[model samples]
Target: MMEPETRESLIARLPDHADTTAWLEFVQLYEPLIYGIGRRHGLQPTDATDLVQEVLLAVAQSIERFKPDQQRGRFRSWLFGVARNHSLNKLRSLRGQPQPAGGSEAFKQLDQVAAPTSLEQEFTTAFRRRAFRWAARRVRQSVQPTTWEAFSRTAVDCQSAGDVAEDLGVEIGSVYLARSRVMSRLKRLVQEVSGDGFEAIEGELR
Candidate 1:
Protein backbone atom coordinates (compact mmCIF):
# COMPACT_ATOMS: atom_id res chain seq x y z
CA MET A 1 0.00 0.00 0.00
CA MET A 2 1.07 3.61 -0.55
CA GLU A 3 2.40 5.63 2.33
CA PRO A 4 -0.29 7.82 3.88
CA GLU A 5 1.44 11.03 2.76
CA THR A 6 1.77 9.78 -0.79
CA ARG A 7 -1.85 8.70 -1.01
CA GLU A 8 -3.04 11.98 0.40
CA SER A 9 -0.90 13.90 -1.99
CA LEU A 10 -2.29 11.99 -4.92
CA ILE A 11 -5.85 12.51 -3.85
CA ALA A 12 -5.50 16.17 -3.05
CA ARG A 13 -3.04 17.39 -5.65
CA LEU A 14 -3.76 15.45 -8.85
CA PRO A 15 -6.53 17.58 -10.30
CA ASP A 16 -4.96 21.03 -10.35
CA HIS A 17 -1.40 22.05 -11.30
CA ALA A 18 -0.54 22.63 -7.67
CA ASP A 19 1.09 19.23 -7.07
CA THR A 20 4.05 18.36 -9.24
CA THR A 21 4.73 15.22 -7.23
CA ALA A 22 1.23 13.92 -7.72
CA TRP A 23 1.29 14.70 -11.43
CA LEU A 24 4.57 12.84 -11.90
CA GLU A 25 3.23 9.87 -9.97
CA PHE A 26 0.09 9.88 -12.03
CA VAL A 27 2.04 9.94 -15.30
CA GLN A 28 4.37 7.14 -14.22
CA LEU A 29 1.46 4.90 -13.29
CA TYR A 30 -0.77 5.41 -16.35
CA GLU A 31 1.47 6.31 -19.29
CA PRO A 32 2.36 2.72 -20.15
CA LEU A 33 -1.25 1.67 -20.03
CA ILE A 34 -2.19 4.55 -22.32
CA TYR A 35 0.55 3.62 -24.74
CA GLY A 36 -0.57 0.02 -24.66
CA ILE A 37 -4.12 1.09 -25.41
CA GLY A 38 -2.87 2.96 -28.44
CA ARG A 39 -0.94 -0.04 -29.74
CA ARG A 40 -3.90 -2.33 -29.21
CA HIS A 41 -5.89 0.04 -31.37
CA GLY A 42 -3.50 -0.60 -34.30
CA LEU A 43 -1.23 2.43 -33.93
CA GLN A 44 2.42 2.04 -34.88
CA PRO A 45 4.95 2.36 -32.09
CA THR A 46 5.81 5.96 -32.89
CA ASP A 47 2.18 6.84 -33.28
CA ALA A 48 1.38 5.12 -30.00
CA THR A 49 4.07 7.14 -28.26
CA ASP A 50 2.56 10.25 -29.78
CA LEU A 51 -0.86 9.15 -28.55
CA VAL A 52 0.40 8.90 -24.98
CA GLN A 53 1.69 12.46 -25.17
CA GLU A 54 -1.56 13.65 -26.69
CA VAL A 55 -3.67 12.01 -24.00
CA LEU A 56 -1.53 13.40 -21.22
CA LEU A 57 -1.63 16.82 -22.79
CA ALA A 58 -5.38 16.63 -22.93
CA VAL A 59 -5.49 15.57 -19.30
CA ALA A 60 -3.33 18.51 -18.30
CA GLN A 61 -5.52 20.84 -20.24
CA SER A 62 -8.78 19.65 -18.73
CA ILE A 63 -8.10 18.00 -15.35
CA GLU A 64 -9.04 21.13 -13.38
CA ARG A 65 -12.57 20.76 -14.67
CA PHE A 66 -12.74 17.03 -13.89
CA LYS A 67 -14.90 16.52 -10.86
CA PRO A 68 -15.27 13.11 -9.30
CA ASP A 69 -18.96 12.36 -9.71
CA GLN A 70 -19.69 8.87 -8.43
CA GLN A 71 -23.23 9.15 -9.78
CA ARG A 72 -21.87 9.77 -13.28
CA GLY A 73 -18.64 7.64 -13.48
CA ARG A 74 -14.93 7.24 -12.65
CA PHE A 75 -11.86 9.33 -13.46
CA ARG A 76 -10.18 6.47 -15.23
CA SER A 77 -13.28 5.96 -17.37
CA TRP A 78 -13.20 9.62 -18.22
CA LEU A 79 -9.52 9.31 -19.07
CA PHE A 80 -10.32 6.30 -21.24
CA GLY A 81 -12.92 8.29 -23.10
CA VAL A 82 -10.39 11.01 -23.78
CA ALA A 83 -7.88 8.45 -25.01
CA ARG A 84 -10.44 6.80 -27.29
CA ASN A 85 -11.42 10.10 -28.85
CA HIS A 86 -7.79 11.02 -29.48
CA SER A 87 -7.02 7.60 -30.93
CA LEU A 88 -9.94 7.79 -33.34
CA ASN A 89 -8.85 11.22 -34.42
CA LYS A 90 -5.39 9.86 -35.11
CA LEU A 91 -6.85 6.95 -37.04
CA ARG A 92 -8.98 9.21 -39.16
CA SER A 93 -5.97 11.34 -39.98
CA LEU A 94 -3.95 8.29 -40.91
CA ARG A 95 -6.74 7.01 -43.12
CA GLY A 96 -6.72 10.25 -45.03
CA GLN A 97 -3.00 10.15 -45.78
CA PRO A 98 -1.52 8.23 -48.69
CA GLN A 99 -0.19 4.83 -47.62
CA PRO A 100 3.57 4.62 -47.29
CA ALA A 101 5.41 2.29 -49.65
CA GLY A 102 6.07 -0.44 -47.07
CA GLY A 103 3.31 0.23 -44.51
CA SER A 104 0.22 -0.53 -46.55
CA GLU A 105 -0.35 -3.81 -44.73
CA ALA A 106 -0.32 -2.06 -41.37
CA PHE A 107 -2.76 0.50 -42.65
CA LYS A 108 -4.95 -2.30 -43.98
CA GLN A 109 -4.96 -3.85 -40.52
CA LEU A 110 -5.84 -0.50 -39.02
CA ASP A 111 -8.69 -0.22 -41.50
CA GLN A 112 -10.18 -3.42 -40.10
CA VAL A 113 -10.22 -2.12 -36.51
CA ALA A 114 -13.21 -2.83 -34.34
CA ALA A 115 -15.40 -0.42 -32.44
CA PRO A 116 -14.32 1.91 -29.60
CA THR A 117 -15.78 -0.44 -27.00
CA SER A 118 -13.33 -3.13 -28.05
CA LEU A 119 -10.45 -0.71 -27.52
CA GLU A 120 -11.84 0.26 -24.13
CA GLN A 121 -12.06 -3.38 -23.08
CA GLU A 122 -8.48 -3.98 -24.14
CA PHE A 123 -7.41 -0.89 -22.21
CA THR A 124 -9.12 -2.13 -19.05
CA THR A 125 -7.50 -5.55 -19.30
CA ALA A 126 -4.10 -4.02 -19.83
CA PHE A 127 -4.63 -1.59 -16.97
CA ARG A 128 -5.58 -4.39 -14.58
CA ARG A 129 -2.56 -6.48 -15.55
CA ARG A 130 -0.21 -3.52 -15.00
CA ALA A 131 -1.89 -2.59 -11.74
CA PHE A 132 -1.56 -6.12 -10.36
CA ARG A 133 2.07 -6.32 -11.36
CA TRP A 134 2.87 -2.97 -9.79
CA ALA A 135 1.03 -3.88 -6.60
CA ALA A 136 2.76 -7.26 -6.35
CA ARG A 137 6.17 -5.60 -6.73
CA ARG A 138 5.41 -3.12 -3.96
CA VAL A 139 4.12 -5.86 -1.66
CA ARG A 140 7.13 -8.08 -2.34
CA GLN A 141 9.53 -5.35 -1.24
CA SER A 142 7.79 -4.84 2.12
CA VAL A 143 7.02 -8.48 2.96
CA GLN A 144 9.29 -11.07 4.52
CA PRO A 145 11.00 -13.34 2.03
CA THR A 146 9.35 -16.41 3.46
CA THR A 147 5.96 -14.76 3.54
CA TRP A 148 6.23 -13.63 -0.06
CA GLU A 149 7.41 -17.06 -1.19
CA ALA A 150 4.55 -18.74 0.56
CA PHE A 151 2.04 -16.39 -0.99
CA SER A 152 3.55 -16.73 -4.44
CA ARG A 153 3.72 -20.50 -4.27
CA THR A 154 0.13 -20.85 -3.19
CA ALA A 155 -1.64 -18.03 -4.95
CA VAL A 156 0.48 -17.52 -8.06
CA ASP A 157 2.24 -20.80 -8.69
CA CYS A 158 -0.97 -22.66 -7.82
CA GLN A 159 0.61 -24.97 -5.33
CA SER A 160 -1.57 -26.52 -2.67
CA ALA A 161 -1.46 -24.68 0.64
CA GLY A 162 -0.48 -27.88 2.36
CA ASP A 163 2.38 -28.42 -0.07
CA VAL A 164 3.58 -24.84 0.37
CA ALA A 165 3.46 -25.20 4.12
CA GLU A 166 5.57 -28.34 3.95
CA ASP A 167 8.04 -26.77 1.55
CA LEU A 168 8.39 -23.71 3.73
CA GLY A 169 8.54 -25.81 6.96
CA VAL A 170 5.59 -23.96 8.42
CA GLU A 171 2.09 -24.79 9.59
CA ILE A 172 -0.63 -24.78 6.92
CA GLY A 173 -2.29 -22.00 8.84
CA SER A 174 0.83 -19.86 8.60
CA VAL A 175 0.88 -20.32 4.85
CA TYR A 176 -2.75 -19.26 4.66
CA LEU A 177 -2.02 -16.24 6.81
CA ALA A 178 0.85 -15.17 4.64
CA ARG A 179 -1.24 -15.44 1.49
CA SER A 180 -4.09 -13.48 3.03
CA ARG A 181 -1.87 -10.67 4.22
CA VAL A 182 -0.11 -10.37 0.87
CA MET A 183 -3.41 -10.39 -1.00
CA SER A 184 -4.86 -7.70 1.22
CA ARG A 185 -1.87 -5.47 0.71
CA LEU A 186 -1.97 -6.09 -3.01
CA LYS A 187 -5.61 -5.11 -3.23
CA ARG A 188 -4.94 -1.92 -1.34
CA LEU A 189 -2.01 -1.08 -3.58
CA VAL A 190 -4.14 -1.55 -6.69
CA GLN A 191 -6.78 0.74 -5.25
CA GLU A 192 -4.21 3.35 -4.40
CA VAL A 193 -2.65 3.29 -7.83
CA SER A 194 -6.00 3.37 -9.65
CA GLY A 195 -7.51 5.97 -7.32
CA ASP A 196 -11.24 6.68 -6.83
CA GLY A 197 -12.20 5.77 -10.39
CA PHE A 198 -11.17 2.13 -10.43
CA GLU A 199 -14.39 0.68 -9.05
CA ALA A 200 -16.52 2.41 -11.67
CA ILE A 201 -14.42 0.99 -14.46
CA GLU A 202 -14.47 -2.41 -12.80
CA GLY A 203 -18.28 -2.34 -12.62
CA GLU A 204 -18.58 -1.52 -16.31
CA LEU A 205 -16.21 -4.33 -17.25
CA ARG A 206 -18.14 -6.80 -15.12
Candidate 2:
Protein backbone atom coordinates (compact mmCIF):
# COMPACT_ATOMS: atom_id res chain seq x y z
CA MET A 1 0.00 0.00 0.00
CA MET A 2 1.13 3.53 -0.69
CA GLU A 3 1.77 5.94 2.12
CA PRO A 4 -1.00 8.35 2.99
CA GLU A 5 -1.11 12.04 1.99
CA THR A 6 -1.15 14.90 4.49
CA ARG A 7 -3.81 17.56 5.06
CA GLU A 8 -1.63 20.55 4.21
CA SER A 9 -0.66 19.05 0.85
CA LEU A 10 -4.27 18.22 0.02
CA ILE A 11 -5.41 21.72 1.05
CA ALA A 12 -2.59 23.30 -0.93
CA ARG A 13 -3.58 21.30 -4.01
CA LEU A 14 -7.26 22.25 -3.59
CA PRO A 15 -6.63 25.98 -3.94
CA ASP A 16 -5.45 25.43 -7.51
CA HIS A 17 -7.90 22.66 -8.41
CA ALA A 18 -8.84 23.81 -11.88
CA ASP A 19 -5.33 24.90 -12.79
CA THR A 20 -2.56 22.79 -14.30
CA THR A 21 -0.62 23.14 -11.08
CA ALA A 22 -3.38 21.52 -9.10
CA TRP A 23 -3.88 18.81 -11.68
CA LEU A 24 -0.22 17.78 -11.43
CA GLU A 25 -0.38 17.93 -7.68
CA PHE A 26 -3.40 15.65 -7.69
CA VAL A 27 -1.69 13.04 -9.87
CA GLN A 28 1.43 12.98 -7.72
CA LEU A 29 -0.52 12.84 -4.49
CA TYR A 30 -3.55 10.74 -5.39
CA GLU A 31 -2.51 8.43 -8.21
CA PRO A 32 -1.65 5.72 -5.74
CA LEU A 33 -4.91 6.23 -3.94
CA ILE A 34 -6.81 5.56 -7.16
CA TYR A 35 -4.50 2.71 -8.13
CA GLY A 36 -5.05 1.02 -4.80
CA ILE A 37 -8.79 1.23 -5.21
CA GLY A 38 -8.59 -0.25 -8.69
CA ARG A 39 -6.29 -3.09 -7.61
CA ARG A 40 -8.61 -3.92 -4.74
CA HIS A 41 -11.28 -4.60 -7.31
CA GLY A 42 -8.89 -6.57 -9.57
CA LEU A 43 -8.25 -4.06 -12.30
CA GLN A 44 -5.20 -4.11 -14.58
CA PRO A 45 -3.24 -0.94 -15.33
CA THR A 46 -5.27 0.09 -18.38
CA ASP A 47 -8.43 -0.64 -16.46
CA ALA A 48 -7.01 1.29 -13.52
CA THR A 49 -6.45 4.29 -15.76
CA ASP A 50 -10.03 4.06 -16.93
CA LEU A 51 -11.19 3.96 -13.34
CA VAL A 52 -8.89 6.85 -12.41
CA GLN A 53 -10.12 8.91 -15.35
CA GLU A 54 -13.74 8.31 -14.45
CA VAL A 55 -13.10 9.24 -10.82
CA LEU A 56 -11.18 12.35 -11.86
CA LEU A 57 -13.96 13.32 -14.24
CA ALA A 58 -16.41 12.90 -11.41
CA VAL A 59 -14.23 15.17 -9.30
CA ALA A 60 -14.03 17.71 -12.08
CA GLN A 61 -17.80 17.78 -12.54
CA SER A 62 -18.58 17.83 -8.84
CA ILE A 63 -15.75 20.04 -7.66
CA GLU A 64 -18.27 22.77 -7.00
CA ARG A 65 -19.90 20.34 -4.63
CA PHE A 66 -16.64 20.15 -2.70
CA LYS A 67 -16.89 22.46 0.21
CA PRO A 68 -14.04 21.91 2.64
CA ASP A 69 -16.49 20.57 5.14
CA GLN A 70 -14.48 19.89 8.24
CA GLN A 71 -17.85 18.50 9.41
CA ARG A 72 -19.11 15.77 7.11
CA GLY A 73 -16.59 13.71 5.09
CA ARG A 74 -13.07 13.33 3.81
CA PHE A 75 -12.33 13.71 0.10
CA ARG A 76 -10.69 10.30 0.31
CA SER A 77 -13.83 8.28 1.04
CA TRP A 78 -16.03 10.22 -1.33
CA LEU A 79 -13.41 9.73 -4.04
CA PHE A 80 -12.94 6.08 -3.14
CA GLY A 81 -16.65 5.62 -3.61
CA VAL A 82 -16.43 7.03 -7.11
CA ALA A 83 -13.50 4.76 -8.00
CA ARG A 84 -15.23 1.75 -6.45
CA ASN A 85 -18.33 2.28 -8.50
CA HIS A 86 -16.35 2.71 -11.68
CA SER A 87 -14.20 -0.30 -10.93
CA LEU A 88 -17.21 -2.50 -10.23
CA ASN A 89 -18.80 -1.40 -13.44
CA LYS A 90 -15.64 -2.25 -15.35
CA LEU A 91 -15.36 -5.61 -13.65
CA ARG A 92 -18.93 -6.40 -14.44
CA SER A 93 -18.48 -5.58 -18.10
CA LEU A 94 -15.55 -7.95 -18.53
CA ARG A 95 -16.37 -11.16 -20.39
CA GLY A 96 -15.55 -14.68 -19.08
CA GLN A 97 -14.23 -13.68 -15.70
CA PRO A 98 -16.17 -15.35 -12.93
CA GLN A 99 -17.84 -12.79 -10.75
CA PRO A 100 -16.80 -13.30 -7.20
CA ALA A 101 -19.83 -13.82 -5.02
CA GLY A 102 -20.27 -12.04 -1.68
CA GLY A 103 -18.10 -9.06 -2.72
CA SER A 104 -21.06 -6.76 -2.28
CA GLU A 105 -21.66 -8.36 1.08
CA ALA A 106 -18.05 -7.70 1.90
CA PHE A 107 -18.49 -4.05 1.02
CA LYS A 108 -21.55 -3.88 3.27
CA GLN A 109 -19.55 -5.36 6.13
CA LEU A 110 -16.72 -2.98 5.38
CA ASP A 111 -19.12 -0.06 5.43
CA GLN A 112 -20.42 -1.18 8.79
CA VAL A 113 -16.87 -1.04 10.09
CA ALA A 114 -15.92 2.13 8.30
CA ALA A 115 -13.55 4.44 10.07
CA PRO A 116 -15.08 7.44 11.79
CA THR A 117 -14.93 10.73 9.97
CA SER A 118 -12.55 12.24 12.46
CA LEU A 119 -10.10 9.38 12.23
CA GLU A 120 -10.18 9.05 8.46
CA GLN A 121 -10.00 12.79 7.85
CA GLU A 122 -7.19 13.12 10.31
CA PHE A 123 -5.25 10.41 8.51
CA THR A 124 -5.90 11.85 5.07
CA THR A 125 -5.05 15.36 6.17
CA ALA A 126 -1.79 14.19 7.67
CA PHE A 127 -0.93 12.23 4.56
CA ARG A 128 -1.59 15.16 2.25
CA ARG A 129 0.36 17.55 4.45
CA ARG A 130 3.38 15.32 4.40
CA ALA A 131 3.33 15.14 0.62
CA PHE A 132 3.25 18.92 0.30
CA ARG A 133 5.80 19.23 3.03
CA TRP A 134 8.07 16.97 1.03
CA ALA A 135 7.64 19.13 -2.05
CA ALA A 136 8.15 22.28 0.00
CA ARG A 137 11.29 20.85 1.52
CA ARG A 138 12.58 20.04 -1.92
CA VAL A 139 12.10 23.67 -2.92
CA ARG A 140 13.67 24.86 0.28
CA GLN A 141 16.73 22.73 -0.28
CA SER A 142 17.15 23.75 -3.91
CA VAL A 143 15.88 27.31 -4.01
CA GLN A 144 16.90 30.31 -1.97
CA PRO A 145 15.47 30.48 1.55
CA THR A 146 14.10 33.97 1.00
CA THR A 147 12.18 32.80 -2.05
CA TRP A 148 10.74 29.76 -0.31
CA GLU A 149 9.78 31.82 2.71
CA ALA A 150 8.01 34.36 0.55
CA PHE A 151 5.90 31.75 -1.23
CA SER A 152 5.29 29.75 1.92
CA ARG A 153 4.05 32.81 3.72
CA THR A 154 1.95 34.16 0.88
CA ALA A 155 0.61 31.00 -0.70
CA VAL A 156 0.55 28.45 2.09
CA ASP A 157 -0.10 30.80 5.00
CA CYS A 158 -2.52 33.01 3.07
CA GLN A 159 -0.66 36.19 3.81
CA SER A 160 -1.02 38.99 1.33
CA ALA A 161 2.11 40.15 -0.47
CA GLY A 162 2.01 43.46 1.38
CA ASP A 163 1.65 41.65 4.68
CA VAL A 164 4.48 39.31 3.83
CA ALA A 165 6.70 42.25 2.94
CA GLU A 166 5.74 44.00 6.16
CA ASP A 167 6.40 40.86 8.17
CA LEU A 168 9.75 40.26 6.47
CA GLY A 169 10.77 43.91 6.67
CA VAL A 170 11.07 44.04 2.91
CA GLU A 171 9.57 46.34 0.30
CA ILE A 172 6.40 45.26 -1.51
CA GLY A 173 8.39 44.99 -4.73
CA SER A 174 10.58 42.40 -3.05
CA VAL A 175 7.45 40.45 -2.22
CA TYR A 176 6.36 40.44 -5.85
CA LEU A 177 9.87 39.51 -6.95
CA ALA A 178 9.97 36.67 -4.51
CA ARG A 179 6.56 35.45 -5.61
CA SER A 180 7.68 35.37 -9.23
CA ARG A 181 10.77 33.35 -8.40
CA VAL A 182 8.78 30.97 -6.24
CA MET A 183 6.11 30.40 -8.85
CA SER A 184 8.71 29.51 -11.46
CA ARG A 185 10.34 27.11 -9.03
CA LEU A 186 6.99 25.56 -8.22
CA LYS A 187 6.16 24.95 -11.87
CA ARG A 188 9.43 23.14 -12.42
CA LEU A 189 9.10 21.18 -9.21
CA VAL A 190 5.54 20.22 -10.07
CA GLN A 191 6.61 18.87 -13.41
CA GLU A 192 9.50 16.98 -11.87
CA VAL A 193 7.29 15.37 -9.28
CA SER A 194 4.25 14.61 -11.45
CA GLY A 195 5.40 14.42 -15.09
CA ASP A 196 3.48 14.77 -18.38
CA GLY A 197 0.77 12.25 -17.47
CA PHE A 198 -1.07 14.98 -15.59
CA GLU A 199 -1.08 17.21 -18.66
CA ALA A 200 -3.10 14.53 -20.42
CA ILE A 201 -5.67 14.55 -17.63
CA GLU A 202 -5.91 18.31 -17.76
CA GLY A 203 -6.38 18.11 -21.51
CA GLU A 204 -9.36 15.86 -20.88
CA LEU A 205 -10.80 18.58 -18.63
CA ARG A 206 -10.35 21.14 -21.36
Candidate 3:
Protein backbone atom coordinates (compact mmCIF):
# COMPACT_ATOMS: atom_id res chain seq x y z
CA MET A 1 0.00 0.00 0.00
CA MET A 2 1.18 3.49 -0.74
CA GLU A 3 1.78 5.60 2.32
CA PRO A 4 -0.17 8.83 2.77
CA GLU A 5 3.14 10.63 2.53
CA THR A 6 3.79 9.03 -0.84
CA ARG A 7 0.35 9.88 -2.12
CA GLU A 8 0.74 13.46 -0.93
CA SER A 9 4.08 13.80 -2.59
CA LEU A 10 2.81 12.40 -5.86
CA ILE A 11 -0.20 14.69 -5.78
CA ALA A 12 1.92 17.73 -5.07
CA ARG A 13 4.28 16.95 -7.92
CA LEU A 14 2.03 18.58 -10.44
CA PRO A 15 4.06 21.55 -11.62
CA ASP A 16 6.70 19.73 -13.66
CA HIS A 17 4.21 18.81 -16.31
CA ALA A 18 2.16 16.95 -13.75
CA ASP A 19 -0.17 17.39 -16.65
CA THR A 20 1.62 14.64 -18.50
CA THR A 21 1.01 11.74 -16.12
CA ALA A 22 -0.25 13.17 -12.85
CA TRP A 23 -3.19 14.85 -14.51
CA LEU A 24 -4.25 11.60 -16.10
CA GLU A 25 -3.90 9.92 -12.74
CA PHE A 26 -5.90 12.64 -11.08
CA VAL A 27 -8.70 12.46 -13.64
CA GLN A 28 -8.91 8.70 -13.41
CA LEU A 29 -9.04 8.94 -9.65
CA TYR A 30 -11.63 11.71 -9.44
CA GLU A 31 -13.87 11.61 -12.52
CA PRO A 32 -16.25 9.00 -11.14
CA LEU A 33 -16.48 10.93 -7.90
CA ILE A 34 -17.41 14.16 -9.63
CA TYR A 35 -19.89 12.44 -11.92
CA GLY A 36 -21.62 10.69 -9.03
CA ILE A 37 -22.08 13.94 -7.14
CA GLY A 38 -23.47 15.63 -10.24
CA ARG A 39 -26.03 12.87 -10.65
CA ARG A 40 -27.00 13.18 -6.99
CA HIS A 41 -27.91 16.84 -7.52
CA GLY A 42 -30.84 15.91 -9.83
CA LEU A 43 -29.00 16.80 -12.98
CA GLN A 44 -30.18 15.09 -16.15
CA PRO A 45 -27.75 12.79 -17.93
CA THR A 46 -26.47 15.45 -20.32
CA ASP A 47 -26.43 18.15 -17.65
CA ALA A 48 -24.71 15.84 -15.22
CA THR A 49 -22.11 14.99 -17.86
CA ASP A 50 -21.53 18.66 -18.60
CA LEU A 51 -21.40 19.48 -14.93
CA VAL A 52 -18.72 16.88 -14.41
CA GLN A 53 -16.66 18.36 -17.20
CA GLU A 54 -17.01 21.84 -15.83
CA VAL A 55 -16.19 20.66 -12.32
CA LEU A 56 -13.05 18.92 -13.59
CA LEU A 57 -12.03 22.04 -15.46
CA ALA A 58 -12.47 24.07 -12.30
CA VAL A 59 -10.53 21.54 -10.28
CA ALA A 60 -7.73 21.61 -12.81
CA GLN A 61 -7.48 25.34 -12.28
CA SER A 62 -7.85 25.43 -8.50
CA ILE A 63 -6.37 22.20 -7.10
CA GLU A 64 -2.97 23.83 -6.72
CA ARG A 65 -4.45 25.87 -3.91
CA PHE A 66 -5.57 22.99 -1.70
CA LYS A 67 -3.81 22.49 1.62
CA PRO A 68 -2.39 19.06 2.45
CA ASP A 69 -4.11 18.87 5.80
CA GLN A 70 -6.33 15.81 6.14
CA GLN A 71 -8.44 17.52 8.78
CA ARG A 72 -9.40 20.12 6.23
CA GLY A 73 -10.78 16.96 4.70
CA ARG A 74 -10.13 15.13 1.45
CA PHE A 75 -9.87 17.07 -1.80
CA ARG A 76 -13.17 15.45 -2.69
CA SER A 77 -15.06 17.94 -0.51
CA TRP A 78 -13.64 20.91 -2.32
CA LEU A 79 -14.28 19.23 -5.65
CA PHE A 80 -17.87 18.53 -4.64
CA GLY A 81 -18.24 22.12 -3.55
CA VAL A 82 -17.21 23.19 -7.01
CA ALA A 83 -19.62 20.72 -8.61
CA ARG A 84 -22.45 21.77 -6.31
CA ASN A 85 -21.91 25.41 -7.22
CA HIS A 86 -21.99 24.60 -10.90
CA SER A 87 -25.07 22.40 -10.48
CA LEU A 88 -26.94 25.19 -8.68
CA ASN A 89 -26.04 27.69 -11.35
CA LYS A 90 -27.39 25.31 -13.98
CA LEU A 91 -30.52 24.78 -11.88
CA ARG A 92 -31.04 28.51 -11.52
CA SER A 93 -30.71 28.99 -15.24
CA LEU A 94 -33.23 26.24 -15.81
CA ARG A 95 -35.60 27.76 -13.30
CA GLY A 96 -35.42 31.12 -15.01
CA GLN A 97 -36.33 29.66 -18.38
CA PRO A 98 -39.87 29.34 -19.71
CA GLN A 99 -41.41 26.13 -18.51
CA PRO A 100 -41.80 23.27 -20.95
CA ALA A 101 -45.37 22.11 -20.49
CA GLY A 102 -45.54 20.77 -16.93
CA GLY A 103 -41.95 21.69 -16.09
CA SER A 104 -42.85 24.95 -14.36
CA GLU A 105 -45.04 23.22 -11.81
CA ALA A 106 -42.39 20.60 -11.16
CA PHE A 107 -39.69 23.19 -10.65
CA LYS A 108 -41.95 25.43 -8.65
CA GLN A 109 -42.79 22.60 -6.28
CA LEU A 110 -39.12 21.86 -5.68
CA ASP A 111 -38.98 23.50 -2.26
CA GLN A 112 -35.67 21.79 -1.73
CA VAL A 113 -33.99 24.42 -3.82
CA ALA A 114 -32.18 26.76 -1.48
CA ALA A 115 -29.56 29.44 -1.92
CA PRO A 116 -26.18 28.28 -3.06
CA THR A 117 -24.19 26.88 -0.19
CA SER A 118 -21.10 28.67 1.09
CA LEU A 119 -17.85 27.40 -0.33
CA GLU A 120 -16.81 26.05 3.06
CA GLN A 121 -19.99 24.04 3.47
CA GLU A 122 -19.67 22.76 -0.06
CA PHE A 123 -16.12 21.81 0.65
CA THR A 124 -17.23 19.84 3.70
CA THR A 125 -19.64 17.90 1.53
CA ALA A 126 -16.96 17.21 -1.04
CA PHE A 127 -14.66 16.00 1.71
CA ARG A 128 -17.17 13.37 2.77
CA ARG A 129 -17.68 12.35 -0.84
CA ARG A 130 -13.97 12.02 -1.43
CA ALA A 131 -13.48 10.22 1.85
CA PHE A 132 -16.03 7.63 0.83
CA ARG A 133 -14.36 7.19 -2.52
CA TRP A 134 -10.94 6.96 -0.98
CA ALA A 135 -12.10 4.42 1.55
CA ALA A 136 -13.93 2.33 -1.03
CA ARG A 137 -11.00 2.28 -3.41
CA ARG A 138 -8.58 1.37 -0.67
CA VAL A 139 -10.74 -1.48 0.53
CA ARG A 140 -11.15 -2.75 -3.01
CA GLN A 141 -7.42 -2.80 -3.45
CA SER A 142 -6.83 -4.69 -0.22
CA VAL A 143 -9.41 -7.43 -0.57
CA GLN A 144 -9.50 -10.56 -2.65
CA PRO A 145 -10.56 -9.84 -6.22
CA THR A 146 -13.68 -12.00 -6.06
CA THR A 147 -14.85 -10.51 -2.79
CA TRP A 148 -14.20 -7.00 -4.05
CA GLU A 149 -16.13 -7.75 -7.23
CA ALA A 150 -19.06 -9.05 -5.24
CA PHE A 151 -19.12 -5.97 -3.06
CA SER A 152 -18.80 -3.63 -6.02
CA ARG A 153 -21.54 -5.36 -7.97
CA THR A 154 -24.01 -5.09 -5.14
CA ALA A 155 -23.22 -2.03 -3.07
CA VAL A 156 -21.28 0.29 -5.35
CA ASP A 157 -23.27 -0.47 -8.44
CA CYS A 158 -26.56 -0.44 -6.50
CA GLN A 159 -27.49 -3.92 -7.63
CA SER A 160 -29.65 -6.14 -5.49
CA ALA A 161 -27.55 -8.02 -2.92
CA GLY A 162 -29.58 -11.15 -3.46
CA ASP A 163 -29.05 -10.91 -7.18
CA VAL A 164 -25.34 -10.49 -6.69
CA ALA A 165 -25.33 -13.57 -4.47
CA GLU A 166 -27.14 -15.53 -7.11
CA ASP A 167 -24.73 -14.40 -9.79
CA LEU A 168 -21.74 -15.23 -7.61
CA GLY A 169 -23.27 -18.57 -6.64
CA VAL A 170 -22.91 -17.58 -3.00
CA GLU A 171 -25.39 -17.71 -0.17
CA ILE A 172 -27.31 -14.57 0.79
CA GLY A 173 -25.52 -14.53 4.14
CA SER A 174 -22.19 -14.66 2.35
CA VAL A 175 -23.19 -11.68 0.24
CA TYR A 176 -24.10 -9.73 3.35
CA LEU A 177 -20.81 -10.61 5.02
CA ALA A 178 -18.82 -9.70 1.93
CA ARG A 179 -20.44 -6.32 1.69
CA SER A 180 -19.96 -5.68 5.40
CA ARG A 181 -16.30 -6.61 5.29
CA VAL A 182 -15.57 -4.25 2.43
CA MET A 183 -17.55 -1.45 4.06
CA SER A 184 -15.83 -1.91 7.40
CA ARG A 185 -12.36 -1.77 5.85
CA LEU A 186 -13.31 1.21 3.76
CA LYS A 187 -14.32 3.19 6.83
CA ARG A 188 -11.05 2.38 8.53
CA LEU A 189 -8.89 3.25 5.51
CA VAL A 190 -10.54 6.60 4.92
CA GLN A 191 -10.05 7.63 8.53
CA GLU A 192 -6.44 6.54 8.48
CA VAL A 193 -5.54 8.13 5.15
CA SER A 194 -7.53 11.29 5.81
CA GLY A 195 -6.10 11.74 9.30
CA ASP A 196 -2.75 12.74 7.86
CA GLY A 197 -4.09 16.08 6.71
CA PHE A 198 -5.90 16.59 10.00
CA GLU A 199 -2.76 15.92 11.95
CA ALA A 200 -0.80 18.40 9.89
CA ILE A 201 -3.44 21.11 10.31
CA GLU A 202 -3.79 20.42 14.04
CA GLY A 203 -0.07 20.88 14.54
CA GLU A 204 -0.35 24.32 13.05
CA LEU A 205 -3.33 25.12 15.27
CA ARG A 206 -1.37 24.17 18.36
> Which candidate leads in TM-score?
1
Q: What C-alpha lDDT, on a 0 to 100 scale, does residue 107 get in candidate 3?
A: 45
Alpha-carbon error at 83 in model 3, in Å? 1.2
- For 1-206, candidate 3 gives per-residue lDDT tens digits of 32143354435655445456666655655566566555555555676688878987776676677774743445545556677778767666778666555555434423564443553454444544565565577677788887987888887688898898888898988888888888777655544544334333223323
- Cα misplacement distance, residue 131 of candidate 2 (Å): 1.7
- Model 3's alpha-carbon lDDT is 0.62
Model 1 reaches what TM-score against the true structure?
0.76
Model 2 local distance difference test score: 0.60
- Pairs of residues at least 3 apart in sequence or in different chains that clash in candidate 3: 69-197, 70-197, 70-198, 71-197, 71-198, 76-126, 77-126, 77-127
Error of 3 at 55 (Å): 0.7
Off by over 4 Å in 1: 1-13, 16-21, 70-72, 94-99, 104-111, 195-206
State the lDDT of candidate 1 residue by residue for 1-206, as single tens digits.
Answer: 32122244354566778778778877877899888777766777888899999999999888778776532356667888888778767877887777666555555655576666787667767776666676688899999999999999997788999998998899999999999999888767766776534444344434
Given candidate 3, what's the lDDT at residue 201? 26
- Tell me each candidate's RMSD, in Å, in order: 5.2, 12.7, 9.9
lDDT rank, highest first?
A: 1, 3, 2
User: In model 2, where is the ten-residue run with the lowest total lDDT?
Assistant: 196-205
Query: Which stretches of candidate 2 lie above 4 Å from their native place?
Result: 1-18, 95-137, 140-206
**Which residue pairs clash within candidate 2?**
5-127, 5-128, 6-125, 6-126, 6-127, 6-128, 6-129, 7-125, 7-129
Number of the predicted model whose lDDT against the real structure is largest: 1
